[model samples]
Target: MTTQFPTPANELDRILTLSDFNVDYSNFDDQFKDLAKLAASVAGTEISLVGLIDSYTQWIISGHGMEIQQTPREETVCQYTIMEEDHLEIENLSMDSRFQEKPFVTKDPNLRYYYGIPLKSEGHNIGTLCLLDRSAKKLAPEKTELLKIIAEEIVNRLKTYKTIELLRHKVTEVTDTKNKVVHDIRGPLGGIIGLAQIISEQGKDNNMDEVLEFINLIHKSGNSILELADEILSAEKKTTVKVKGDELNLRVFREKLEKLYVPQAKIKGIKFTVSISPETETVPFPKNKLLQITGNLISNAIKFTPQGGNVQVNLVLTARENPNVLRISVTDSGSGLTQSQIDNIIEGTSTSTEGTDGEAGYGFGLALVKHLIDGLRGSFNITSDQAGATFEVILPQ
Candidate 1:
């Protein structure tokens, strides 16, 4: 009897989530290569792999102790693993009823062991991180938990990658829009200038009828310019406000920030934590704008902070105010910035500086954050001392 394979009930949604990462299978990333190595070490296995399962194939994005790149989804043992909630551990693949007839298990290398944890994104399992060996073995419970943490890290890195790509795309869109505006305006502007010169010459020659005709031509040209401006600028404004005006949930937003920064802080040997007051569970605010504001602030703190330092973020609601206020503060145990540096950042003129570990920075984020806050009619403040620094923002709720 042929063994039946299991598929997630939300398989379509799973595939869509995978697509959002815009993963490039042709040139695989080395970041996952390191994760595969760490997985192999932690599992004490001879081979480990990070595989992504699409609709029809299993893409082995990164592998340690092996050169295999991909396999047919119908024949992959990982297809079953992706359907698992936590993990699948087979002490002997050759003895398992489901996989015993598989060619890889019965032929050639005759693999005997398989252990896999599903790679979940957006609550759907899209792939697996697995260990393969020639001998049957069991993993310790503690190690199993550690492997789970590594799986979470893989998903977090994927999310961060997607966000960076999106930001770059937005920057390109803004530049293109600016260029279009300048290019389109030049023609109408030139016509108005020419008509004005004609009107001046006619006036100097004391020809009132001709001068009035030229003036009328200039008025028509000016109206055309106004129409072009309204058409382009209005469309842009509509789209921007639509995206930026959507309401944000404080709880969900906080979770995203933790996922984005906790791993970064860990790599830098810094402690990171976020706190949201009970009263601030939900707020009618723009998530993307909040992300930009806090992302820059938190990133700045972590970059400047030395190893073993602490970075804390807090979001609280002020009930005493007539319109409740949302207060955000990012505090860090980093090298304090000078007054001149602070002034430059507020003015959006600050240059990049090397971090505690010599990491390069452009120092543009804080300036962008300042601009965003000003547009919201919010307040941004910076306080620093020899011990550490704090950046605070207050927005009306």
Candidate 2:
């Protein structure tokens, strides 16, 4: 049977999202290889494959008992699997009109049984976790459920992989930004240095007017340095700020924050905790901005705190005022902030400071948080002593 190759209605979107993985068409990752092996074991099949199908190719990312890396989309049974919302199992691929004439079935491999669970991401079926066998057979109900669970695991891994890729890209951006800022600062700095050197040499001449002119130039150069720093930092800010908001479940939000920071803290030998009041359920807020705010606070807490220290995130619903308020706090068991740092934070000009472990700081934490809080018509507070510190945010609902 010669049938037209089936394509999803969201083919363009599906392909675009799939490209985010940047996966090598033939690279068989071991994590996915294990998943394929398990899938095959559960289904009692000779061949199990984890394949991602794109416009014209089915990239066999991982497979058990199969060496073929990829195949033409039209020649692959998985082409039809991605179209369905759930698992697609064909007891006999040779008997199924949709796949009978496919090259893999009619010629090489001569596969007779097929079962595929769609690998879904962002509402699109990007690939499949499939099992194939030479002899016709049916998969048991329990085995099919197990395959579905494995498929979900594959999707979760994909999400985590994509997130890691994004973080790597952001790190690159930050490194480049810092490099550019350092290079650009040299121009004004050189001017100031040259002017000061000239003044020292001319001091013996009692040339008061020339000295004053040099002083003015030096002052202007100093201002230029500050302005340049602000310009570059503001440019970085553009990537983080959001203009829109979403109705987000607070429970999910808290869990996500904990998941993100807990691992980071653990890497530094710090204990991280997130606590939300039981009454808090949902909030109307820009999710990304909230993430940015909390992320910066938690990151600073972890960075400043020494090894074996503690960091915490707290979310509370406050009902004492006319409009209900959402209170979020991040506390760290670390050396308290210096008076100079506190003043800079209050003046919205806080600069980076090294952590206890000598980790280089990312400039502008509390200042940015203050700006975001002001935008939200909220309040930001900080309290610190000889022992530790706590940063609080109060948003009225």
Candidate 1 residue-wise lDDT, 43-123, digit = tens: 999999899886545778889988876664667789889888999999999888878998888886788999999999879
Per-candidate TM vs. native? Answer: 0.50, 0.50
On lDDT, the leading prediction is 1
User: Model 2 RMSD to the real structure?
Assistant: 21.9
Whole-structure CA lDDT of model 2: 0.74
Give the lDDT of residue 372 in candidate 1.
Answer: 69
Question: Where does candidate 1 stray beyond 4 Å?
Answer: 1-3, 196-397
lDDT of candidate 2 over 1-397, digit per residue (tens): 2234476778656765675564434334676888888888999999999998754457787899888665545567788899999988899988888778877788878889999889999899999998999999999899899999999998898887668656765765675679687668878777776667667557668668777677767767776776777777677557433321122346766776775566668767999988887754543333435655676688788878999999989988665566867788999999998777777786777766667776544354565567667867888888898789999998876
List candidate 2 stretches off by more than 4 Å: 1-3, 206-397
**Model 1 global lDDT (CA atoms, 0 to 1):** 0.77
